[model samples]
Target: MADDPRPAARRRRPLRAATIGTYALLTALALVYVFPFVVSLANSFKTDEDAANNPVSLIPQSFTTAAYQQLFQTDLPLWLGNTVVVTVLVTAGRVLFDSMAGYALSRLPFRGRNAVYAGLVAVMAVPGVVLLIPKFLVIKEFGMYDTYAGMVIPMLADAAGVFIMRNFFESVSPSIEEAAKIDGAGVFRRFWSVVLPMSRSALITLFILSFQASWNELPQMIISTQSPSLFTLTKGTAQLASGALSAGSQFPVKLAAATLMTIPVAVLFFVFQRRIMNTTAGGTKE
Candidate 1:
C-alpha cells in the first residue's frame, strides 16, 4: 500500500509547483503586454483632459465619441480608402508571388535554386530599417515614388512570407504531384488546381499575415510615397500621433486612430487564427 508512495508524491510536488509558477509568470507577461492596448482603448473614448490626466487608467472619467468624430472629419476616410486599396493589392500579390516562389524553390529543380533560397533566408535576417534607404532609392529610380504603385509594389512580396510558404510547400507530399503529372497535368496546372486546393490552411495563414503586415507597415509606406492621396493608415496614423490633425496633445484622437487601425487586422486574425495555428502545428495529407 505504501510502496514508494512518498517518492512518487514528492516527484509530483515539484512538477505541480513548476506548472503553477509557469502559469503565474505567463499571466503576468500577458498583462504586461496587453495593458498598453487596454489603456489605449480606454483613452480613445475619453476626453482629451481625462486621457492626459490619467494616461494609464483603464476607465475613462468621461466617455465621448468626439475623438472618432474628429478623425472622420480629417483625412481618416481617405487614409482608410488608400489603406484598403494598398493592403488588398499587397496581400493578394504576396500570397500569389510567395506561393509561386516557394513552389519553384521547393519542387522545381534548377540551377542556383539553393543559392537563391539561401539569399532569401539571408534577406530575412536583415533588419527592415537597414533597407529603408535602399528601398527609397529604388522607388525613386523606378519612378514609382509618390504613386500608388510605389506604395503597394515594394511591399508586394516579403522574404518572411516567401520563407513561410516555402516551408509549407516542402511539407506537402510529392506523390500527389507525381500522380497529377501522370495524368498530363503540367506544373502550373498541378500547382493551381491540385496543390493549392490542399494548401488551404497555409494559404489562409499567409493571407492573414500578409494583410496585417501591409496594413501596419509604416517605414515602407513612408519611403514609398509622399502624396497625401497615397497615405495609408499607418502613415496617416503616425501623422495624427505627431499632432498634425489637432493641438494640445490630442491623446484621444491619436489613440482613436490607432484603435481603429487595429480593428481590421484584429478581426481578420480572430477569424482565421485557428487555421494559422493548424498550419504551424502540421499539415495533413489527404
Candidate 2:
C-alpha cells in the first residue's frame, strides 16, 4: 500500500465521484417530485386570479384563505364526514380481514391452499382498471349500489394487503404459536392474543397503507355510489376540479381541496414511514 498509494487513491476517487453524482441526481429528483406539492400549497393561499396566473410559482402574489372558506361553504363538511367514515371502516376491515386471511394461508393446512395463494397473486397482477366494470356489476347485482356497504365492503380486503400479511406471518417462528397451543389456547385465541400482538409492525404498515388507499380512492367510489350524501373527498374534489362547484379556472379552490385532501395521508405516511421501511426490510429478509 505504501508503494502504490496512488492506485488506491485513484480507486476511491471514482467511487467518491459516483456517490456524489448519485446524491446530486437524487436531490434533483426529490425536488422535481416535491415542486408541484409546494406550488399547490402556495397557490391554495392565493386568490383565484393569482393562482391561475402563477400556477407554477411557489410564492403567491397575495395570500388569502378565501379558497378554504369557499370550500367549507360548499358540501366539504359532508364530504369530509363521509370520507372519514368510509376510510375508518375500510381500514379496520382490511386490517382484520387481511391478517386473518394471511394467517390462514400461512399456518392453516387446507386443500388447495397453494392454488388459492396462486389465485391471490394472479389477482394482484390484474390491473385494477380492468376490474372496474365487473366490480360495478357485482355491487349493483348485490343491491349495494349507492349505499355505504357498496363503498366499503368491496375495498375491505385487498390482495396486496393479504400478500403482505402472509409474508410477514410466514417469517414468524411457529414455536410461539406452538407454545400458545400447549397453554390450551384455541386457534382464534392464539391468533388474537399471541400472533396479533407480535405483528404490531406489520399491522401498522397495513393500517397506514389501507388508510391512504381508501382515503384517496376515486374509481371505486365513482362506481360504487352516485348519491351526493355518500360522496367521499375524492369524489367531491373531482367535482370541484370539473367545475361542478365553481366557474372560471377556480385553480385556488381546486388546489385548496387537493391540498387539504393530501394532508391526512401525508401526515400518516410521515409518522409511520420508518416502520414501513423496517417492515419491508424484515419481509425481504424472510
Candidate 3:
C-alpha cells in the first residue's frame, strides 16, 4: 500500500505552525525583557530634558556623553573599584567555602550531617531582610562596620550555593571516588583533583550567580558600610538615582551609571551561557 502523503503533510502542518508560534512568543518576550535596557542606553546618550521628554523613545534629539563625563568626575570610579573588589572576594569565598561545605555534606559521613543540612535549608528559607539587624550587630560587635571585612565576610558562604554543589556532587558517580580512595588520594586531594574538576559546570554556574548577586548587592552594603570610600556601585547608583548629586532628575547620568554597572554581569552571562545551558539541561534530564 502506498503511504498517504496528504495525511503526513497535514500532521507536519500543525507541528510547523506550533513551532512558529512558539518562536514568535519567545521573540516577543525577549523584546519585552530587552526594551528597558534599550531605552536606558538610548536615554543615557541624551540630555536630561531630552531623556525626560522622550523616555520611551530609542532615538535622541541631541546625543551627548556629558552624563558619562559627569559620572567620571564624581567618586563613581572609586565606587566601581570598591564594588569590583568586594564582588571578586565574595565570589571567590563563596565558591571555595560553599563547594567545600557541599562536598563534605554530600560525600563525608559525620554525626549530625542531616541536622546541618536541615539547618541550611531552614536558613535558606529565612528572608534576608529578617537578618539585617542581627547581621549589623554582629558586624559592629566584631568591629567590622564600615570596613571591607564586614562587606565580604558575611557573604562568604551562601546556603544556596552549598545546596547546589551538594546536589551536583550527589549526582556524580561514587565509583570514581572509590577508585581514588583505593589509589590513596586523601579527602582534600580527592575533592581537588577528581571531584572538583568534574564539577566545573556547577562551579561556573555558581560563579556567575555569586558574581551577579555580590555585584548588584545593595542592602548588605547599606548595612555594612557608611563611608563614601566603601560605597559599592549599587549604593552609589542609588544615591545618584535619588538626586543627591544633581537637583533635577538627571536621567542620563543615572542611566549611564546603571548601564556601566550592567556590563560586567552581561559579559559574564554571555561567556558562561553555554555551560549554564548544558548544566540546566543535564539537571533536567536527571
| Shift of residue 153 alpha carbon in model 1, Å | 1.2
For lDDT, candidate 1 versus 3, the one ahead is: 3
Task: Give candidate 3 regions above 4 Å deviation.
Answer: 277-286
User: Total clashing residue pairs per candidate?
Assistant: 0, 0, 0
lDDT of prediction 2: 0.91
Q: Could you tell me the lDDT of residue 13 within candidate 2?
A: 99
- Top candidate on lDDT is 3
The C-alpha TM-scores of every prediction are 0.91, 0.92, 0.95
Residues forming the 10-long window of minimal summed lDDT in candidate 1: 277-286
lDDT of 1 at 191: 91
Model 1 clash tally, residue pairs: 0
1-286, model 2: which lDDT tens digit per residue? Answer: 3596889999999999999999999999999999999988999999888888878888888979999999899899999999999999999999999999999999899999999999999999999999999999999999999999999999999999999999888887777778879989998898899888778889999999899999999999999999999899999999989888657899988999999999999999888877772453332222
Query: lDDT score of model 3?
Result: 0.91
Candidate 3: 10-residue stretch with minimal lDDT: 277-286
Clashing pairs in 1: none
lDDT of 3 by residue, 146-181 (tens): 999999999998999999998888887777777889
